[model samples]
Every structure is written in C-alpha cells, then in structure tokens.
Target: MVKKQNIPAKEKIVSVVLLAGLILFMAIVIGPGFSEPSSPNQNVAEQMLPAGWSAVGGWEIYPKGRLYEKINGREPLFDQYGVVRLRYASVSKGTNDFEVYFYDMQTPDGALGIYLANTPSEFDELELGTLADISGGQVRVLKGRTYLEIFSLAEQTPKDFLIDLSSALVETIPTEKEARRTAVELLPKQGRVRGTLILNRENTYGLAKLTDIFSASYQQDNDEFDYMIRTISPSEGRKMIAAVGEEIFEFDGEIIQSETNSLVAEFMGKTLILNQTGDFLIGLYGAVPPDQGRRRLDQWIETMKDQLHGSGK
Candidate 1:
C-alpha cells in the first residue's frame, strides 16, 4: 500500500540527468559512425618542406602510396649524408622537437669517432655524439654532420617547406676553392731555411733562406727568397730569354738581368754582378768580394752549367 505523491522539481532534475547519461552511453556503443573507423589522411604537405623548393638531387621520397613531385638532389627530413642524419617527429603533448645524429664513417684504423645527440631539453644540446638546435623556425646542425631540418607544429605551407629544403641544399653544395686558397695564403709559413740556391724546379727560381737550414719559420710572416730559380733545363734557355727579354746584362761572359729588383744571371761563366740593391749579398756562395771572388764565381758558374747539361744528358 502506497500513497501517491507529486515529485518535487529537484527529483525531476535527477531523473533528467540519469536519462541523459543513458543516452550518451547508447551513442558511444551504437552510433552510426562508431562501427566504421574514420581514417583521416594526414596532411603531410602541411607538415613538411616549404613551397617552391623541391628536394632535388640527393633525396628520396617516403611514405607508401603517396605521390610527390620529384626534385633532383632533394632529401627527406630523416635522410643522412656523410655519416650524419636528422630525425624529426611531432610530440603528442609537449612542444615540437627533432634530433641530430652524428656517426663516424668507417675508418681503416677501426677507431670510431664518437656519436652525438641533440634534443629539445637543452634546446642547444651538444653531446659527445650529437649536436642540435632550433633557429629561425628550423632545426639546424651547427657543428654536427647533417645540415638542416624544417618541421612545423602548425600547417606546413609550400613556402615554409621550400625554406627548409633550400637550407639543406645550401649546406650540401661544395664550398668554393678560391676562398680556401686565400685562407691558406693567410696562414703563417713555417719551415727551415737553407743557403740561397737557384730553385730551378721547372723554372729558374731563387730561394733564400730566412733562417738557418733545418730551422722552422713561417713563410707568410718571414721574408722569402726574392726570385725562384729560372731554368732547370738548358733547353729552356730560349724561353728564359723571352721571359727576361732586354733585361739581360753581359757580365763575366754570361747574360744577366735585373728584374723585379733582383739580379738574374743566365749562362754566365765569369764576373758575377755584385750590384747591392741594399745590403743583400748576390755573389757566388763562399766567394769574397772583388777580383779573387770573381774567379771563384766564374768557376762556380761553369760547374752549374755542367751540372745542368749532365742532368739533361
């Protein structure tokens, strides 16, 4: 036996809440789309390389069943070169990030250079085996092997995509050799200096020692012998004549010239020129000044001529 009573507004509210919960449960279990899994295609273009820049030359396209415009010499984001690779992946919850890996190329000695890793925690992490950094909206290798990687937390546009690709391309291109040559020229020279000798290595050039023989000195910093030895072969005499044309002098039975501020003696047998441009000595080695030295110089010149002819023979 029960007395029927009107439900209060609060009770009605409770009933409504329970009914909504049941409806939600039914929707979860039997919704029309629930049985058919939704396969949304990932918009990779919006996720990777920027526009206009194609991965030309040395790159491979990835992902199965997808078509990409072939850009020669272009590479994938994870590709490697010269024992280095760049790896990129989107984070599930945290900030976007990527990594750089450096590996030692196989060496004959069997000792490997260390591996390096760079990650986002340090942002500029430089480990023994890897190095990585994020800059200008791109993750680039400053010191480690592989050059650059561009990814996006936002949609990737063609513009952004090409920006990354261009970076990689720029990194891969060979540096100009002239710049390297100039750098080498700027480097200090170091070597031993011997007594002055005509360095006729292919051409007659002069070499004067700035230091004692076997001593070390920087060529860039120290003064070098003025002229290289002129001729190594007697057959090269005509060419030498052309090279020294009209600058010749007839002294001690030899044709000599003063060119580039140094006396150039050619096929001379006697009477060496002692024209002191300054205090520098130019006579035959071990010979003193004036007449007595002149005789010795003449003899020495004859010996040189004989050596040259014998070598040719």
Candidate 2:
C-alpha cells in the first residue's frame, strides 16, 4: 500500500564516497587523541649508555617528593626554578661509575635559572646548546627545557668517559641552541667574573618582589664584590623603588636620597646599595663605600644604556 522510492545509482555512489571522506577526516583528526599521550622527549634511557658502558640500574623518576631527597636537601633552590621532573640513572663499565641527572625544567629560562644559581666553574664550552660548563670531573649543559648534569660517581672516573656520555645524550635529546639574548648579556664583559653571572629567580636578598635578578662578581684590588641588576618594566620600576624604600626602613638602614633613585644600606657587615634606573633595579653588595659603589654603579648603568641603544632596546 506504500509507494517505493529508490536512489539513483550515481546518487548512491556519491553518498557513499562522501560518507567515506567524512570518516577518513575524522580518523585523521580525532583518532590520535584517543591514544595515549606521548612523552616529552625520546626515551632518555635508550640513548644514555655509550659504547663502553652499561646502565648500572633502571631509570628512575623523581617527582616532587623524591627530588627533594636526591639533591642533598636543596629542594628550595630547585623549586624556585620551576622544576617539573627529574630523571636519573647510573652507568658503569668495569670499576668506573658515572651518574647522570636530567632536570626537566618547565622552560628554558627555568633551566637557566638553576644553572646560574649553582655557581659552576667553566672548563670547556660545548656546541650542544645555549650554555655548557665542564668542571670538577662533571659536565653541566643547559639545552632548551632540560638541564643535564653528568658526573663521576667517584672522581676516579675518566673525564673523557663523562664527555662521551654527555655527547651521546646531547645528540639524542631534541633541542636547538637558544638564539635570544638574555638580561645577563647587558653586563659588560670586562671585569665580570668568569662563569659568575647568576640569575636569582625569587626573593633576592630577602626583599619581597625582588626577583629575576642577574648578578655577577667583580674584582677591584683583588677584592671580590657582587653587582646585580633586575630588569622590570618601566611601570614596575616605581614599585621596586617603593618596595626597596619600605625594606630599607624595615632594616633600619639609611636611604640616600638622590636625583637617581638609590639607597645605601648595611646588612651583615656589607654595604648594599639599590638603584633604580629606567626599567632596571640595580644593587651592589659587599664592603665598597657609598661613593665607590655609586661610581661603579653609574659606570655599569652607562654601559648597559650603551648596549641597550646599540641593540635598539
């Protein structure tokens, strides 16, 4: 009692093709999300062992809790750097043992934060990435989001072995050399202590909101003192000046009023001066007198201004 309708052969064929295309599109776009998420880097354990050594033990992951235990209770320092994870393993060949630690920082800057804070001595620079320093039978490399430290379990292990292992790891971990300049570059190369540029990431010198500070040691008359600069926006510069003002009062230190915002304070037998110039908060720490500190600070500020102008900042 019902009239029957049939699709044309060509129309049926077109519908089938369209349905097939839609399914294919969904498969391509939505299928991968259904699978497990991939790891950050290629399996580090596989690339760790070199030609002459074997992994002494299985790879271990140290999340927040275990990470605190592994670094000799320096958790606060690592935390400030925004560490996401730590991966470690040991390798041995014959009697020589090597320990490798990979700190998976949240970002390149975070990795740089820890590297600068550690006060490493410079030995040989590597082509692996932005910064690498080899010292005391160990190698520290900062590449992208990873900070790697390879050291001998016993200082008896050969340095060449550490270098070889590090080279392998560097080739495996996916990272390109950092191309951007950093605030530390503003410091004049002359008279800056080698490998002493440190980025203090938080609460620098017990002053609240005093952070992102880059400091380096300078030598005059063979006396070592530290000079530091914190880069802030021109708007935030006023806030820093106010914070330093309040801090000076809290510490019972005298504030040296000047046309250029600066203050003189004595803390623990060392004279400290905080200066604000444009978008920078500058500080000098050590036994330098106020006049000498001001002179040195002015020179640094001028040098930074010259560098900034040259770079079009």
Candidate 3:
C-alpha cells in the first residue's frame, strides 16, 4: 500500500523546475544531434600549427582580389580553380623552418582541381585529407574545400614534423563528399582507373576552348584511351565538331560525319570521336580504328547518360 502526502504549491513548482533542468542537462551531455562548441575556423590555421611550431609573423590573409600581392604570377592559376582566399604563414620548429600556405578553393572540386593540376609526376604520397602529395621537401594536401602546402626552408626536409603539422590542419576541416562524388558521378564505374578523374576548369587537353571539363582514362580488354565529358548545348557541340574538323592542333585530321550529329576524326595515328547527348558533350581520344572508337565512345556516352539520370549501376 502507498500513502500520498499533499505537497505545497511552491515546493511542487520548484521540484518540477529542477526535474526539467536535469533532463535538459542530460540532453546536452549525451544526446543525438547535439554538438560540442568548436573553435572558430578562420584562425584554425594558427590554433592547429602543431605542438612545437609557431608562425613567424602570424597568419596573413589574402583574399582572391589581393592574392596577386602574395603570388603575382600564380594567382591566375588559383583564380581559375575558384580559390576564395589564402592564409600565408612561415612556421619554425627547433632546427626546421617551413613556409605554409592554406587555400580556400570555395568547393571540394576546386580544391581537388588545383591539387591535381599541381601534382608532380614523381613523388611520395601521403594519406592525409582526401589525398596528399609530397615532392622533395614540399607537401600539398587537398581536404574538403581547403588545400594546404608546407615548403621546407633551406631545402631541409623534415618529413615527420611536416606530416604532423598537416594532420593538425586536416582534422580541423570536416569531411565533404563533393570531391569524392565528382569522380564517381562524372566517371563510369568500370575501368575508370579509380583516382584518375580530373575536374578541369582551365584548358583541357591544352585546348583553350575546352574548359570546365571532366577527364579520365579507361582501360578495358588491354585497350586504353582518354575520355572527356562536359556540359554543352547541341549548338555549341556542333560548333566544336566543326572546329575540330578544320584542325585539332598539330593533328591534321579529316572529320567524317557519323550518326546524325556525331563526328569522327582520324589523324596522326590517333582517332577522335565526339557527340552531343542531351546537354552533355562526350568524346574519346587514343582509340584507334574509327569504327571501334565510335563503338567505345557510344558505350561510354550511354553510361554517362545513365549516371546523369540517376540510373547508373
């Protein structure tokens, strides 16, 4: 048996208030959808400079408009990649000194674009961020919309310290799927060479007219060729085909009309085929035998169409 005692109104109100406070406290401490307070991001470059290092003159910010103040000749390259700004600093730890550069490329794809454009042909690699490249004493990383570089002073290569510093910055940026998704979305699943996708906002294949293109290589049945895809209207596509018909750089090729609006060109022992499918311009290079090149190009174009329509396997 239980006995009930009448409680005073004031005490009852206080008890209810205390109970509500406890519930709120628990929700904040161990609840889903609640995040801990975080340090401000703009200054993260300084806060995450690693344990034993310090920026020589603090971090200097250079907006896109003023980037030329810091890097006169290279600003155009970064501008093409959609860089939003840059954070520059010189860091030193014990006997090692480094020049650090942090770039905000505005989007993950932009970050990846600049990273790939600058990647050296031969270099050691690091698994930091989305990916990192180490050439000599310099290291570059692409993380979400951010790209980081650390250049060794006096040609001194302090590999371990540079990695540690990069790790600290990488942890500050949250992971984003844009860079990863671009490769998967724009390239076919089969024989895509995995990490070979390059989002080119600048001249593609050194063709000034071809910008904002996605390029990758495919290898199947011991045959390899480069494929490119870009958003283009039918009218523009026809114009590009006409331009290629006249001349494709040093490759003097003869353009032959294929299907309705499709065209094929064979020159200098290389075959090039291009067509406009819906709002996309799809093409192939290094594929020989005009018939075989058209076949492979058509197959890849179909795959890309399926991907764009959300029916890709």
Candidate 4:
C-alpha cells in the first residue's frame, strides 16, 4: 500500500497544454470553410432570364429594379418576350424620338423576324407583331430584320422616315433578284455606281456608297479592301472577321477585325463579301444594275433571314 499525493502545479500545467493542442488539431481538420456572399443583381439575373441569357457588358439595373441595356450607345432599353422596346424622353430630338421593337415571326421556311418601324406608316400592315409605335420615335418589329430605324415628328415630309425605313428594310431583308433586275433596268447608266448592304445578328445594318476602294494590310498582315458605310454596329469594331475572300470573285476583303459574335459581308462591283460569326450573316453587294442589285440584295437578305430564323441566332 502507498500513500496518495496531490498532483504538482507544474504537472497540471503540462497536461492542460497537451489537451488544448489536441482539441485545436481536431477543429482544423474537421471544420467547414467560409465563403463570401454574392451580389444582389447577379442573384436576381440568375433567377430571371433563361439560363445562359446573361447580361452583357454595359448593362445596369434601374432603381425600379428593371434592367436596361444600351444599343449603339444611344438608347437604354428593356427586353420583353424577345421584343426590345425603348422609351424616349420628351427632350430627345429628331427621329431619335421613337420606340423600337425586335422579335421573330413564322415564315414558310421557318421564322422571319426583325426590327421594324411601328409608327403610323403605310407599311404597318406588313408588320408581323402587334404595332407598339405610339410615339413618333417608336419602332415595331415588322417584316424584316431592321438593324436601325429612326423616327421624327419634326419632319414636314415622310422623306426622312422613308429613307431610314428603306435603308433598314433593304439591309436586313432579302431582295428578289428578279425585282432588283427590273429596278436596275430603270436606272440611268453611268460610271460604276456602287452600293453595299451589311447585316449582323445584333439586328443592325450598314448601307454605304463605295467610292474610295483601296487595299491595306489588315489583321495579321493580310491585304484586303477598305471601304466605308454610313453606319455600322458600334460594338462590331471589336468582333472577329469572318470570310476574307470575295463571294463571287477572288477579290480580297476582310470581315470585322475585332472580337465580335456578329457577321459581316462586303461586295464590290458585283463581288460578294460574306463574313459570319455564330448564327448571324453578313453580306456585301457591289456594283450591279440598279434593279438587279436591289433584287439580288433583297433575295440574299431573304435567304439570310431564313437562315437566322431557322438557326434562332
């Protein structure tokens, strides 16, 4: 038998330290990790638009909780049922004063859709959706892919409306080669009169009179024709160039040189320029008889429209 004794203070201290270390090691090995919280807008967007339909750059959420996206740096708009409608303030000037819509329609080939002038025009009957162009600046999704169309209550004549509308119509929709041929027959023959029409999936078109045609070193030292247009998709500057060789001829041309999901095409003297990215088609038409050119452009646009509808780009 031995007498029991109280533990020394030094021994008690060492035992407590060892027990604490064991507990710390177990916590570190088994505990869960921490993470940061997500933003409110991102959370809302994830819940809204269909999967993969994310907000592109330059999009903002308004105080009312609505999301607005800008088009070509001019208007702030919202999308509803695949239709883009823009509301203009009273202070806005010119044909800049309207609402615009973008949508798809069912066609014989598939779906024919585009941007349209929804205003009080004689062509409204040709529109595929409900007319929503109440304001002078409003546009409705009509028959063709209208990249851009402006409206103005200040104009004394329908000339401005017609010019914009015709340009938009001609750029996105395909023309009948026969109709263009007939139209060409009516023009007065002269030096090579050249015009080009371009369409992109972003619902935009560029119509230009090609005068100064030249070649320059483009994208990674390739030589291609340089031309001009009245207007183009503002975002197209950075999109990728698609086709480089001429469609009907071997003439060299370059498509968009930047990072773009859009398509581009150019035509010079009956030569066709075709560039495509994703489901968008870009076409260029050069010098041809007036009627013939118009018809051909229209027919081509029709074909492209069909392609876009079928592909849903």
Q: Give the whole-model CA lDDT for all candidates, comma-separated.
A: 0.31, 0.71, 0.72, 0.31
Candidate 3 global TM-score: 0.61
lDDT of 2: 0.71
Q: Which portions of model 1 show Cα errors greater than 4 Å?
A: 1-73, 76-88, 95-134, 148-150, 155-313
Cα lDDT, model 2, residue 186: 58
> Could you give candidate 4's per-residue lDDT for residues 131-164 as a string of tens digits?
1232333333333222323344354435445344
TM-score list, all predictions: 0.18, 0.59, 0.61, 0.19
Candidate 2 error regions (>4 Å)? 1-77, 89-97, 107-109, 116-137, 143-145, 153-155, 167-178, 184-214, 222-224, 250-252, 258-272, 275-280, 289-291, 302-313
Q: What lDDT does candidate 4 reach at residue 65? A: 15
lDDT of 1: 0.31
Worst 10 residues of 3 by lDDT: 33-42
Winner by TM-score? 3
Task: Summarize candidate 2's per-residue lDDT along 1-313 as a digit string, tens digits.
Answer: 8989998999999999999999999898877434432233334565666676766556767775457546767878888888987887777778878788889887666787888777454576665656777777788887777888888878566767777778887765665464434455556667777777788766666766667788888887755678887656554655666776677678776666533356676655667777766556677887777778777878777766633322112
lDDT at 162, model 1: 30
RMSD of each: 25.6, 10.1, 14.1, 20.4
> lDDT per residue, candidate 3, 217-274, as tens digits?
8888877887877756667766766665555544555665645446677655677777
Candidate 1, run of 10 with poorest lDDT: 107-116
Pick the lDDT winner.
3
| Stretch of 10 with least lDDT, candidate 4 | 211-220
